[model samples]
Target: VFFFLYIYIYILRTIMANLHELPGAQADSVPSAAKTLVWGPGLEANIVLPARFFYIQAVDSSGRNLTASPGEKTFEVKIVSPVEEFTRIWIQVLDRQDGSFLVRYRMYATYTDLYIHILLKNKHVANSPFILNGPVYHEGCDCPQSSGSVWETHMHCPQSFPQIDRDLALYASVDPERNAQEIPQRFGQRQSLCHYTVKSNKVYVKTFGEHVGFRIFMDSILLSLTRKVQLPDMEFFVNLGDWPLEKRKPTEKIHPIFSWCGSNNTRDIVMPTYDLTESVLETMGRVSLDMMSVQANTGPPWPEKNATAFWRGRDSRQERLELVKLSRAHPNMIDAAFTNFFFFKHDESLYGPLVKHVSFFDFFKYKYQINIDGTVAAYRLPYLLAGDSVVLKQDSSYYEHFYNELRPWEHYIPIRADLGDLLEKIQWARDHDEEVKKIALTGQQFARNHLMGDRVFCYYYKLFQEYAKRQVTEPNIREGMELVEQPSDDLFPCSCHRTRVGDTK
Candidate 1:
């Protein structure tokens, strides 16, 4: 009986010991895998200059570190190819006390490609490449500081500001039967006569041909600034250019609000305004810009596309109407149709062979796509070029932010504003199939590289920085939460673990 009791006690103790080891055994059985790499706090694919310090944290599948020792891990940061000597130095890895690590460096100019690599116990853990856009500042240039009088000068308009009312009244009195070219040109000429130039320091504020609405004008300028710079609220920093003008006209019970239009006031700014600003950027609202390459993913491959040239738009301008006539004359070569009758309800009878509206993506089905300007440069140019179709772009006086950077014929086939050479251009493209395809490829690549939302943001950031320098008084915009409550180290890691390297305070 004594021997049996002793054996029973030993068995019970053995079971308890195994149970104690169960937790450790289960932990060892689970696979420790690093899943994703995340950017630092408030850090995105777009990074502006003077923002040198930020971190990239690597986490396991469970969102926790597999190990918490710097001695047991490896971290490296590298600026990707075409790296200039100016950007080569100062990029270094900080001690990874926990799972989180730091990459600190100052950029002289913009860099689109930057990479980070991490390893745990000699095994590759995480790798990522990101974009950083910096303002181009030249050394030895005596840059003027911002001041008060500059704001007054930029906001001031010509003495003939009241003439806009007269121009509108005269435009209304003009006979609708007048030649299509006569009305727009006559109004444009009158507007040009009414224009005046105001200068504050070296910066000048001049009028464009027509009056773009106050809301659209203000929104576009702010969007370009906010989309790129993570700075103070521009609303707080700067006064609306139109607000002062409106206040000055106290006798007018109601200010004349113009229809949506484009601006030459923003010409020096170099970026063009899009009709879809509200839909695309959600600048004033919460709309997120869709970054996916829609043209490549949704459109049919180049080989399967139709050989005919295609165009579609509302009857907004004389050039567009001419395009419709050309399409009807050469139906086989050109497929053009009215997509909307919103602006020209009375002219419905004039439209012949109009088809139901088709999605913009459908335009990519044809091998050749025609891009013509609406009010200014048609905002669709970028979206059209994104596709695999070769673009026959009508030359216009208007240009967008990146228009200066693009090469004609190399990136797209250029046609005159009159579009008289449309048929000839189409035939040339048809005969040179390989060359047309190459142009399409080139255009697509250019759009992807330069017209991406991140790239656009960078362009605006640089423009605003330069614009701000011209001002006599600094903008009075309110600072954001991130800037106000900047972290103790001046950097915040998304992860809980953090290591301090220097006196960030």
Candidate 2:
């Protein structure tokens, strides 16, 4: 037995030595085309319930194992909807031994296309999209038995739909058409903008995949209309977001409308929707409302909180790095750090010593909160506004759905993008304590009065009601296409328990 074990161990060591000598073994030797991305087992088009670990490996063109190269040249993964690039999640890569990396995403939400972008020195070496589908299984249902029914199913889970916040009904306004020449009128009226007809007459919304933002907008609109909107009854297909025509191979012929565009500059010609994060209605699940209550309950009032302006988030862009630099210079007056520094290249001496993360409640401990632009407009703006701390916002071109309504100085102080005047702004806020407190109260009032969940639904209902009329003809919600429901698990499957990689949610 000992002799046999010795021989087996010897063979394994020999294999490892030979693998290191392969052409693709070293970073310098491997040609750009020679590198390949591969998925681990059970990562099929229709994924099973109780998701398994999603793994992706970096290999040589010849299929030999190779460790993932980090730093300047590395792998970046995201799962985004083709039509509405608005819905996206950045997937974090976990390094394994040899040349493979595990994609640490729990398959809780159903998404299509694994968007992979491999860059070397900021140049794209390879970009590919692979399909990743969700299942039709119920929480208590045996998923394996009905696994084959995933593609044929649509909208079985009612809980996945966004519910109407009846308390916010007061925010609903008169139809947009009624006030085409002026701002619409608002009153406390429980009116259904659109009504559901007989099942055959109902319009079916076919989502290419699950996008939280898109889903919220669509679901709210549908729920307001009682799910009456549907595809047109005529021949052909329509497109929403950027559903690729070449890649779409539906089982049936249908009309597709090019509706709902976001994220990228490619604006939708019909129903233009901005980032939903601006409203508390759509992002209730992503942002903690409990934090707001906690802030109001236990934290000190504006005058008693920490005087330093605080900010913490991923190092997604150069602006965030600049914020960190300022914090380092005035560590006592300002607090900042990279929520996760592993993804970006940074000077350790400059950022490492000060790197740290704070809890959501921590914002209430400080009298001022810093807001800056991330990949898009900062998603944390609404959350920050709820903290009752004076907000020091940087100038940004990116706007959310309701950004136009927020006035600088009245609600929050606006700083230059270069952060040249952050210190001056901070000093001014401290000197004018009464004025700062008023601004903080105004920002908090805006969030409480206008950005609540139901108000968000009202926006969707109005937008869709107007958009629905613009269709060449009244859209008929007849049944004939495939659609999928969003997942409603309290916690989305994630690689890390505390944080989701590259995502605010």
Candidate 3:
């Protein structure tokens, strides 16, 4: 009886230890193994959720870690629907301490590659360029074999899509008519943020030009992504070039564009790089100017008139003459070499009210500061190449100042408003994918000749082993991960382990 009781006690303890990590094991606790804690789509992949969602933190296997907040999405999580081409889903795992992730696999809008994480090894490259070709759900239709609609995934918009709005939409709608071109699409009645039935399953979006309302669904995938992005009325940002009569009239030098509609802005389906060359060509013609560039009462290094400056009118005709002198001296200054001076004379009229309200000081700082600050770690080529500045992360100080440290309503924006940036980014990807590929793929002769997906995986896997424990299970990686081992630490291992490594490798 004693022996039997002892044996039973031992068996019970072992069973308890094993079952301790089960779903209902300890209220609200999800174990490492059972928890499919996907964290990121890397730096470039995030539109709705930033990469910080997958930051790194660790605790004992017991899972005791104090968290700063219950949930804050990072790892650039975005769960999107399968709609257009080049669309994909990104994921990773986190420590759940501060909600930092260990590995992140994000979908690059242009590069159809996967960022896979292997245990006790480095990451492998996954070809994610292919869009969903499987049957998509319409809910409005029947079940599996029903009259459900399927997406062919042909839409491949650029990386940085411009902010879509009524003006822009209307512009695109009428643009084809304006240029007498063929219109390819019928405007869908899709509203942004339109909700759908919630079900827990893998959701993948196809491309940049999915329904406008689709952005609301981005956070639903990364449940931790809760920050709502309210769109800012940017009619003001667009009208910044219209200076009061002091300078030239505001003609759309920097007009909004739709990549789909080629240069003439027609609704012509374009290949990826077509619009990029056009945009770069257009921007090269115009330059960014600011208060620093503005000429003040005191002359700078050179006292000749700068074309652009602030003007104050005087009651005396003599003062008026002096103003004319200033304008004459700086004729090429306030306005460019090409405009009609009549626009400035028309000022205090069309451009005055618009100019008075617009300072741009606030906007410039945020554009430069926030964009620069947030993208510190990712500033490296993987996040962006040099040309695609829109998605290219700025500095983190900007992110800290604008987001973490700044008060509400001051340079404040939501994830939704980011749609503008999102579209623009997608456009950039579409436009500059080749240049980006060159940068990502080019390094040494080895990189040039051998840096395909598998080799890249091996290189990263070697790094992962040196830095962290990553295991490769995707079968694609099994051979690569096995062959490489850290040699410095172990000159030799036991014969059995060596044989095992030999067999596996």
Question: In every candidate, how many clashes are there?
Answer: 9, 21, 64
Model 3, span 324-396: residue lDDT tens: 3433555432111212233345442422222223232222111111121111211111111111111223222
Q: Using lDDT as the measure, which candidate wins?
A: 1
> How close to the true structure is residue 341 of candidate 2, measured as C-alpha lDDT?
64
Where is model 2 more than 4 Å wrong at Cα? 1-287, 290-298, 346-349, 353-356, 474-480, 484-505
Comparison by TM-score, 1 against 3, better one: 1
- Candidate 2 accuracy as lDDT: 0.48
Model 1 steric clash pairs: 146-472, 146-473, 147-472, 147-473, 148-473, 236-476, 236-477, 237-476, 237-477
Could you arrange the candidates by lDDT from highest to lowest? 1, 2, 3
Report RMSD for candidate 1. Answer: 19.4
Residue-level lDDT tens digits of model 2 in 13-115: 8987787466545542343433555544224443222222244445554655453333212555555555444543424454432244445333334343444
Report lDDT per candidate: 0.48, 0.48, 0.24
Q: Model 1, range 1-505, lDDT digits (tens) per residue?
A: 9999999999998886676346433232222335535454113322322223345455544554422333323555555434554443345454333344445443333333444433444445543444433222111111222322332232121222122332233222222123122323433443421111112211112233444333344344343332222322121111112211112232333222222232332212233344333333432134322222243233565677899999888887788888888887899999998877665667667775567888766777799999998756777777777776899998876655556667888999999989989999999999999999999889977875655443443443343333334333333211221121111322211221122212145
- Give the runs in model 3 whose Cα sits over 4 Å from its true position: 1-36, 39-97, 102-163, 169-177, 180-256, 259-505
Better of 1 and 2 by lDDT: 1
Best by TM-score: 1
Reference-based TM-score of each model: 0.49, 0.46, 0.21
Query: What count of clashes does model 3 give?
Result: 64
